[model samples]
Target: MSEKMEVDTPTTAATEEKKAEHVTPSASGESAAEHPDMKLAQAIHKAVLMSSNKIPMDTAHIDTLKADLIKMSNPSLIESLASPLQWDLSTVDIAGMKTANETTLNELEEKVKEAQENAGDMEVLEARIAVAQFAAKSMSKKEALAMYQLVLDLPKLSSGKQMDALMEQSRVCSFYSDTLKNKDYIAKISKLAEESGDWDRRNRLKVYTALQNILTRDMKTAASLLIDCIATFSCTELCSYPNFILYTMMTNILYLPRTDLKAKIIDGSEILSVKDDVMPVFTLVKCLYDCDYKGYLQAMVEVESVLLADRFLFPHAGYIMRELHVLGYKQFLDSYKSVTLTSMAQSFGVSVDFLDVQLSRFIAAGRLTAKIDKFGGVVETNRPDLKNAQYRDMIQQGDLLLNRIQKLARVVDV
Candidate 1:
């Protein structure tokens, strides 16, 4: 009985040991509710679910992937997994390469043909028809007889908005250089201007261009051309107007500067006479400032009488008088008791240093005797004898002074 009891006790003990091994928990035996990794994964899944709910899920694949990502505790792995599923650009195929190539070639050919049409070769321009084309291209349909010029003959060259651009260009060019006046070039330019549709620009060019030709070429040709152009352009329906250059030229060559010409001249009473212009005024002032004593005295007397008689026409009288004083014009400065350096500088729009230089030079040359004013801010000068001698010498020697005097004489009504 004792042996049987011992055998049963050993088997019972072995059975109890096996049961204890099965009951004891392993490291991974924690329930999903208790495990920290599982809890973190669940929390991440809930967060991802909430966040992704608002975002548009474009595809079933994207929705499935987003659900999987929410379940992943390791968020860093999402980017690596996501890169493949995102927009697959390789699936798309573009097909315009051949079409684009054909289009570009056609455009390039058109551009070359257009260029050839506009830019007649320079060697070709040496020919008659080519030169005509060149001129026509400039004048176009804008003007009837106005031949415009170009920076170059190329159609792709510069742009101009005016209808008479070609005509103005040709005129400016002809004036700038004498070499542009080839007989062939002139004929071509004239023909081009004649073909232009614009009546005004055509007439203007016909008149001015003819004058240019006359001045540079021959008087007889100019006179004949002018008579014809004036007659053709004289019609009021064609926007006729008197050409100043044509009138001046005709007066010089045919009519002469006699009593009639003087009588016909525009006066200060006219709205915009040449005498009232800044150029003439400046020319007069510059002559006076250069110490042309007799010239100034004579011109001054003439100008003053005019100013006094026609004060309305001479609004700049006070300003001019002030400049004379500031420039150290002793006669005028002494004549006007109100003359002072401050007043002179204020009115003349010139620097005091310039005035000082003029005064010092005049004084040093024994032209005038200058002394500082009571205020210690200005200098004054006067000497009638010096003014006369200096002016007479200036009139004899200075071409600029002579031209200015002639210009003034031409502009003056008297």
Candidate 2:
């Protein structure tokens, strides 16, 4: 117990705040009687001593005990923490998958309850505890939400726990295509993260917020937030080279380019290098940036697996597909006044019939700015006069100037 003691500091305090969330709840909701002073030590020993043969190693709460156990020279305890994240004991026996998982889940639930009881009411463990329980049970969306909400509602959940709960909720809602619910949960999490003074979490929360905003009609806001996230995060030393960061950087530029961020993306390349797995995503962005329609389509096919596996990224990936297709069509229509559908298909790497349908969608959406002649198999581009384009640019610049001046006036008054 003496060796288990750590000096209490603000950082350690923050981490320990939700330490209770790792435990599964008891059926009776009553914790075993334990002395307050020895609770954390007891919980650590119990968790170590438990039969973890069937327990998945990805338990979030287990991370807290990692350093201490290592200091105590506990190799078996460390090894027990290294199983596949989604692996479950129940999945082993086909006949008893649910029953096995449920039994293990029940045991975890009892352990968590006792741990929390020993640790005291102020234990901030909802986030870790909720995640552990949810993973163990592998419950349906309805059941997960109900159980998770109960855990979330517990008193004294630390900011980290709250964010975890929100993130877990976000994942659940994402699976069900519950866009509105995802938006609400992320929005709440964003605010909580800000208040918690966890700068890293707050920055990452921007990604989630941007994702949900994209699901809604607020694309402009989403783009802005993504740009900010990419710029802020990429420039940092904290896990900056993740595939998602690069994707965000590229996606923002796909629809709206930010001058400041584009430079950061290039510089951060040296510090936070891209992984090989994310190469296709990078290529896709390059294609879009370079106006290489052929490459863009190829890169899209290449990154299909990455797009499907990433949850936060999964939803926005469609935008990339749709926008890139639109951009390709926009580019394809650029050099020709009229081109046969067959020629267009060959250039863009698709069937003539598919191009015809895709072109029609582009046309109907008012994106193509051209007409598809079905009989002739010709897709024509409608180019505006240079004089008209120049005039429109003049008006747009004037509007921007006027808005800036108005904003400046308000600042002056303040």
* Candidate maximizing lDDT: 2
Residues 1-414 of candidate 2: C-alpha lDDT, one tens digit per residue: 111111112335656665434322211102211111122333343343333532223344455554443333323323433352222324233334456556756876776676565655443253336444444235455655666676677665555656655665665565445787887888788776544534455666666666666556466676677667654552121122364464465455456543443455433553246535467766766675566667778888867646544444455567767876887788667878999989888877888888889899879989888998778878888887899999999999999999999999999999
Off by over 4 Å in 1: 1-169, 179-184, 192-197, 214-260, 268-271, 278-414
Candidate 1 per-residue C-alpha lDDT over 1-414 given as tens digits, one digit per residue, 9 for 90 to 100: 111100111224546545322221211112111211222222233333334552223465456545544333222334423444452324322123224434544554454455446644432222322233233222222221132333234332211112223433443333223324433444554564433323443544455555455435444465555544533343221111323322322322232222432333322122124334323332344344454444543455455433332212133345434444444355445544344666555544456666567656666666555654646666554435888899988877798788889999989956
Worst 10 residues of 1 by lDDT: 1-10
Cα lDDT over the full model 2:
0.56
Poorly placed runs, candidate 2 (over 4 Å): 1-119, 123-143, 158-160, 172-180, 191-197, 213-223, 231-242, 258-272, 300-322, 331-361, 371-414
Candidate 2: worst-modelled 10 consecutive residues by lDDT: 28-37
Measure candidate 1: CA RMSD: 42.4
In candidate 2, list every pair of residues with a backbone clash: 18-124, 20-125, 21-125, 21-126, 21-129, 23-112, 24-112
